[model samples]
Target chain A: MDLLPFFQQLEATTVGRVVRESLWMFPVIECVHLLALALLGGAVLLVDLRLLGFGLVNQPVDLLARKADPWLLAAWMVIIATGIPMFLSEATKCYYSPPFFYKIGLLVIASVYTFTYRRRVTRELAYGRAPLTACASLALWFGVGFAGRWIAFY
Target chain B: MNFSAFVQWLDATPGSVALRESMLGYPMIETMHVLTLCLFLGMIALVDLRLLGLGFQSIPVSEVAGRLLPIGLAGFVLMAVSGALLFYSGPIRAYGNIFFRIKMALIMLTGINALVFHYTIYKRVASWDRDPIPPLRARLAGLCSLVLWSAVVVCGRMQAYNWFEKAPGA
Candidate 1:
């Protein structure tokens, strides 16, 4: 079995070459990645904390969710854009790395959790039911963050 | 005079020696540090961006802040643990590193800024609660936060290049 196909594909791409070879590219892209992460982190903190009944006790849950949605979307967009290129530049390394794989998996789970939290959980909680999804949402995102950090090592 | 000596003594401690000698210790600690950083910064930015009107427009500032607190705190916890481990592994070197020093200073500033936001402006803002534009203080805090945190990240990245070098005079 050819284990290096992804690496071969990466080697063939001009952008991949630049990402790997350019002195400034990694730092610049990493900066963008961090910025995007900040945006995502901030937005999630607001909504998730509310679900846990910490902040904005007076405000309706749905209203809070609506307010924070845009920033989350923008942050995710930036993350995807910057993250994909970084991933592509070192596909082989990333693919073989367990932490990288876990990060990607957690990210997908987080995205799904975000949607579910909004649609099913937030709406139910707005009517005065206790938020059941808050704990899970928090855990998923934390996993994403933890796994993301581990990627550097793995 | 005493402070410098104390720093030197701490660096020479057995715990520090053990930390450096552990096989996977350094890499694991570094990885955890970066992860916590991402978590801490990520959560803060999400909340802050909301305050700045990036997302969740219909949500109350208080509500948004409330929801993100636990995860943020958890991130902080992880950071503290991992960060201490990092310092332990290279006490003398990190202590003398300019980038590391700067990063620590900025982290303190960020914490202070956060406390101020939570205690004062946040209360007032929540009362008004739906202002089209964030209050002057809130906006200022937000801007300061973004700059300080970004500075922390830059300093962190620069740490690898800023370790102590032998002085010619010494």
Candidate 2:
């Protein structure tokens, strides 16, 4: 299905129009998005670092993950919430933007892998695969962040 | 030389001109700068949160600081290098930006806060390192760091909008 038509329609919605029309609105939302990104990035970094045997050496992987969980969840919630309006305001542009697609693709994979595979591996204390998992996790998440930034330039 | 003249001279340098004019240079540096924030601010926030007794209550404060400090320091190095490149790319613009001024002030304040905490309260970590709730001074330091760093981020982000620039032909 050609999703361009749907995206165009979505951009016509009231929320989209408001966000797009107001000069300050988009920037304000972007600031919030970035703040949440810091928190989420921090949470992800700590867990991934621990798994890689870098820092937090004495703390158990599962315990550190558990401690960082609330922050991760809260930050993700804010990021998604802020991200939606940003997408809506420029849905059609995003549809045409390759970086937008790349960002979304990376975001989905990162989220799934983080919660499922990474979580299980940490819980199981799979030391052998921990480094690889940590590397993959960082690459995927940072890939998302990079592509997200590229959307503007694209 | 005066500060403004220095900024103007720096902005006019060949390297700065190339960075600003290059299709990839500015954006790449900017992307690196933004990406590293997660690492830099993230670690700092964790330590700050612990100091404030907000999170990671089970771990001793010293361990939290010791282990994470290295990572945070590494992130800080990246942040600083990329940040300097960004400033080098457009010194005049940054020098004039109100948000940039605020960000600089906040960063300096954060540095002072960290130094004070380390020398005064943090020197006695053995006394309160085991306590989930740190001493009042330590907690105050954490609170200040959180607030100042957050403001720094806000100002840093806002610097991009050109909100303070005079409207053309006004």
Candidate 3:
């Protein structure tokens, strides 16, 4: 699939045009994106910290994960929803931006790690693997955030 | 010295000028500020939600508050340090920015809100720790905190834009 053209066309679309041209639109969407990032960070950290036995230790890991699931899902929804337009507005820039690719790659890895190994360990009360999974999850997500910031600077 | 003079002087200091003009200093501090925000607000949001009987219904409010508030406070310290660096790097610009002023005021309001809840309703957590639904005052505090903090985040993000600064005539 030739994605370069797709990115070019995406940026030329009306949504992209409006987002890029309007003074408030891009910033407003960015604000929502950042707010959701914080929420997502919170949701992910809560469960990860619990798994590491550093947060809500008295509560069952499964229970903490279950409660955080909704918030994590909600924050992801908002982040992606806002993120799309922001990307569309500058798709070409993102296409050429190594940091943007790094962010997306890390986000994919983080999501898969969270739902797969992290979920299973939490479900089965696997204490031995808990710290490792939690640390991995934190590291992957941290990479995503760091790269996201780098995209702006790059 | 007066406030304006202090800010002007602060902005002119070698340290401040170096940080502002350095290739990586401002953005690095900003990244720290933004990243720590997640830890700070994320933990506090959880406590506030529990106070509002929104999430963490299975746990006692006291435990939730006890375990989480300390981490949140630690995050706050990091955030405050990074935030102070950001201000120091550009004292005059930050002091003059309307959004920055609004963000500071909102932060103060949230601080007062947190203190009031801590000294008043939160002091009595043992009474309603397991209720799942706190009393009206406690819930109100939680709601106020959520709203105020959201506003603070909005104002903080707004500081990046030059909406007001681009006014027709300064």
DockQ for the candidates, in order: 0.34, 0.86, 0.76
Off by over 4 Å in 2: A126-129
Residue A25 of candidate 3: its Cα lDDT?
91
TM-score of each: 0.77, 0.97, 0.96
lDDT of 2 by residue, B96-133 (tens): 99999999988999999999998999899998988989
- Model 3 captures what fraction of native contacts? 0.64
Q: Candidate 1 lDDT, tens digit per residue, B1-170? A: 68667778877898888888876778778766775665677666656765666455566667656756666778889988988888877777887888888999999999899889878888787564676457778877777787898898877776765224566686
Local error of candidate 2 at residue B93 (angstroms): 1.0
Mind giving the per-residue lDDT tens digits that candidate 2 earns over A1-154? Answer: 9999999999999999999999999988998899899999999999898878887978888888888989999999999999999999999999999999999999999999988998888777733337898999999999999999999888
**Model 1 steric clash total:** 34
Give the C-alpha miss distance for residue A1 in model 2, angstroms: 2.4
Can you write out model 3's per-residue Cα lDDT over B56-137, one digit (the tens) per residue? 8889998988998898999999999999999999999899999999999999999999899999988988899999799999
Q: In candidate 2, how many Å is residue A140 off?
A: 0.5
Q: What TM-score applies to chain A of candidate 2? A: 0.95
Name the candidate, 1 or 3, with the larger lDDT value: 3
* Least accurate 10 contiguous residues by lDDT in model 2 chain B: B161-170
Q: Rate the local accuracy (lDDT) of all candidates.
A: 0.73, 0.92, 0.88
**Ten consecutive residues with minimal summed lDDT in candidate 3 chain B?**
B161-170
